[model samples]
Target chain A: EKSSNIENYFRESRLEEFLKLTKVTNSYGIFTAHHLNDHIETFLMKITRGSGLQGMEGIKEFIELNGLKIYRPLIQIPKHILLKFCYKNNILPNYDYTNNSNAYSRNRIRNNIIPEFEKINPNFLESINRITKIISQINNKEKIRLFNEFEKLEPNYEENNISFSRIIFNDLPEFDKKLILKNNSEKLSSGTFMENKHLDYIIEKSYSKSNNFSLDLPGPIKLIATKKRITIEKLFEIDFQ
Target chain B: EKSSNIENYFRESRLEEFLKLTKVTNSYGIFTAHHLNDHIETFLMKITRGSGLQGMEGIKEFIELNGLKIYRPLIQIPKHILLKFCYKNNILPNYDYTNNSNAYSRNRIRNNIIPEFEKINPNFLESINRITKIISQINNKEKIRLFNEFEKLEPNYEENNISFSRIIFNDLPEFDKKLILKNNSEKLSSGTFMENKHLDYIIEKSYSKSNNFSLDLPGPIKLIATKKRITIEKLFEIDFQ
Candidate 1:
């Protein structure tokens, strides 16, 4: 039942459909076992495709998708370790056949990739695991401080849109300013991260205008730059509600 | 020593530097992470940058980075969990201060973004997590299978480069073709994973019966495409010894 739904989730929803139905059973959050291998792949994908800071972040441990809380605890572990664990435990896990064919970009990583590191340094995986943990810890602290500040800085949302005062945002710590923009934008659309260029455009636009201005995102979110603040709103007929 | 090295690694290497190093690693059958968040980020970043399918892939968990290994394990995590964990643990994590400053495009995701779904369904994170985990597992299994197959279809690398035989790659799988391209083009000087536009240009150039074929990546990697073979070489001084 789960696998079928999982396959359908990919083929059908484009990741948003599931976002609509899930409910945070309590004040609870979601979780996953992400590890160093995952982080390297993500970084490669983003940088290879010409991504900015967010892409460079390795892997995020948590995010808000549609009101649900998502989390990853195993990001520090290596797949080999997990494989080793499974082997030691006599757990014969399911192997996806498609990975062997390399029809997908990711399969190339598992099949045609990953082994060369064992040759370069037997402990490469362990080293990366350590590095990622440090990175994760540092990033975690920053996230908390930023989120606290974000909760305090209320974005003025009017007429189904939200914005922040340019003057107020400028007064904030540079870090806070960026956090405000990211979190506030999410209020408009879930599961979306803008690019460095686009964020630059937004910042550039935000400073020059007081009138209503907007940037289009993947979801039904619009980033509106206003005279007093920046607001995000859902366009007409695209009721996220 | 390790802590200092880790910090130095972070300081000395920017995203671009890592990309340069990883390309060389790819030739040796390394893999990087290409998970859910990465997929999402890649998809968004590509659209913003107006890139192609390759760009949409973001980072992959297992990639051949010039024979080095790069992996990601946290792509399945949601941002909120990282945030909450830091908050609850009082971790005081480090953040990309620029993210809060709105200096880049991704700040939008960090700030005024993706919060509405919380107000609506409340389980958005859980839903995306579910999908990400399922897909990630499938990807993992596929990776192992593909690796075994790759070992069987190994092309003899002459002069530390694979002979460019479309027949050798075409029959394996589409993903294998990408892997072969990735493998041969490891090292910034080897011309692997260059721009999609440049890839097409190279392919177009390939159609012509030109014995002297050459392509340059952003850095020192150069590809001299011959009528019957593609020679991969580093155009810059690399410390292999």
Candidate 2:
């Protein structure tokens, strides 16, 4: 795994540990204190990495994975507020030294980029929170609309494969088309989301004059565009062998 | 004028000068050397200022104002490429000394924020340009759709005032609702756009239990929401007096 993916790796490992602990303790769910500052830093990081609207929703408050509920109740509360609360309650919060090491992009954003934004607007975090709230609301509506359009296409799903009419797909709006491709690709790949470039490649090939074309997506997914239809299928190790 | 608006002031002054020069020289239009780097800087600035999707489109490549067309032919080209071409041609480009001043947010973003982004991705500018292109395409389609929705309401327009059914307006999607308010506010105010807070205030009040309410927008526009309809009117000096 790359250094950049270390954060995700740790997060997954921690969640797995939490799941095991939860089952042993018979707990209802897990709560992590990811605050507003962390949320804003993530938002900035996503923008720098060139994420689409779907990626700009910032951190979600609630998520459920493998029958375990994950909640971030402090997402709306700023870090300073949380720290003050801790101090008032005589609670000693652990300060991870790695956060100040600047070894990670998130640290760089927190130490460098956020201060610059604060110089522009003292309430930058709150402002970003408001904007992202609106964005998430819009994303929710768009998600429903996109699902409706995808369902209207009468897509056929067989095991790890999904297929839909090429003409109907082509006629959809560019945003919806890209989203539908993303949604289906994620579904077929068991939650592996394709990058914008991969989706763009599939869309471009699908619209090309050629009658048939095949491309490999990041999830080891196979996308075949024929004269009448487009199909995406996840490839397993057996198929590769 | 506030110090923050100095850039807009200079831009408008420059455009006026360009219009005068164009008429005198019998030129068709004006071309400005705003390259990809500048575009990315503006994008970062907008994000820091908590802009919505519409504001994330960055800079426009072309603008037609008062019968004089303004073009940014270098918008797609990177500043380094332009500098290299100028060096090869033995043409000296003037470097604005003020650009290095951290007093301006744009300068801070260009000097501080962007280098950090480069550390994350070597081709960050190109990535940003691609994302913004997709965003602009989506914005264009959304603009047309929003206009169609606005027209479906069959709004009444007279002089500097426009009115539509409150129930119909309330029924539109959140994104479309905000955008329609923006579009109409700009139209009534002769291109002055209201901030998100003002639009949110209007929307919130419109949905309140009160049967009748009135509020002032940034453009000095008056928004009056009644039981059956909502009206927005630009207030002139005479009306204010």
Candidate 3:
């Protein structure tokens, strides 16, 4: 039934199965062999999709979901190196059928786009790696700084609700304000982050002279802004009426 | 002879001829019709070439080149809209023969990569436009902040030379320090900016306990670091020894 959205189904179903397996086997984490080439391809895909810095973060070495840990131990290794090691060990690699076909966006990028990039700069992958490393480092530092500022704001959290002073939020730099709102939204909704446009709308409304207004987000999260405070809360089924 | 390196020659010759025309005509600026599609193409090309935020800034509406002002009034307009306007007026537009050929990187992006991107997101152009706009705005704000911080360091500039306190420079964030060094190098060299690798090398050395070291850059720009100071100076022909 979900075949029409095969990509989403594949991702969600894989995770669902993996979580069940982890519980059955009592494993703390699972490691995947995503390499440098995969990382670069993901970065290129994000750029084409008009991603901001957060989205362009490519792949991380570690991440946790619902108390389950995932690790990418070979992320820094190049695919060629892995292939060489496999060959030397007389190990045949399993290849995904779709990876060789251009029907997928990632395959197209790997086949068409990356070769042209290589023609422009033979060491383009290394250059991309270096640049993204620097960007990620800067992003990490900024994330720490922003999180610290958010903590200092003394936001109040109730059951299914998070609220802070609109006056203080309005005083923040626009970029910082947007990030704080995004982080809080993601927190209250577990993992769903608000889109930039939605955040912009809420921010614009927050700055308006109106004393009271409310907006609904995709997670049925409601944001209410008043004369002095802004509240983000998860709306219940009955609240929709 | 120049035809062997046609792209560079074309760019340099065009700029040189334009400057002469500006002087002869006594005009403050010249306007070129570079639209949104062109900007997006340039952005994609830069990404393929592994450009940083500055390179990915696409094109500015106005830029000054050796006292000649250049303007792109149609920068925000999409090419299709301009074409429609031209057609409605029964105007014949001049097309560049090379633009239709995939020999050029820009043309390849226009013909091949972008169509694939459209399939991924039909409104991909607008999405790219929006993201780049936000990135450029953030970049401009950060530039101002970095420049101000650079100014506060009170770097001393002599003819063909600029120097600042190493202690103060070392205290800056890695990203800011890299930008400051890049900006200063460009200033001293009258527009030759250092590559990220070179900047990284300089920055790594600056943090080292070694008190005195000197490095030579492409423009014969010399960077000398002492226990307390770092100097950037343009080296003349006789200084090569």
Top-scoring candidate (lDDT): 2
Give the total clashing residue pairs for model 2.
0
lDDT of 2 by residue, B1-241 (tens): 2332344344445567888999999999988788999898887777677777766778789867645798999999999999999999999997766444334888788888889888877788987887688678767877888878998876998886899989888888766788888878766643355786777887887777889999876544788888988998877632211
How many Å off is the CA of B39 in candidate 3?
A: 1.8
Candidate 1, residue A228: Cα displacement in angstroms equals 1.4
Which order, best to worst by DockQ?
2, 3, 1
At residue B93, candidate 2 shows an lDDT of: 97
DockQ numbers for every candidate?
A: 0.02, 0.49, 0.42
Sliding window of 10 residues with minimal summed lDDT for model 2 chain A: A1-10
lDDT of candidate 1 over A1-241, digit per residue (tens): 3343334334325335434444423336556566677776665444344443344456777766545666877766777788899899999966545323213545444343334333334554554444334335534656787767655556556655665566666567544566567666655554345544666677667666447677786444577665776666765433222
Give lDDT tens digits, candidate 3, residues A117-186.
7776777777677657756875787789897888766689887888898988988888889888877776
Off by over 4 Å in 1: A1-36, A50-57, A60-64, A71-74, A84-92, A95-104, A108-113, A144-162, A170-176, A187-190, A234-241, B1-241
Estimate the TM-score of every prediction: 0.40, 0.80, 0.79
* Candidate 2, residue B148: how far the Cα is off, in Å: 1.7
Candidate 1 vs candidate 3, DockQ winner: 3
Native-referenced Cα lDDT, model 2: 0.76
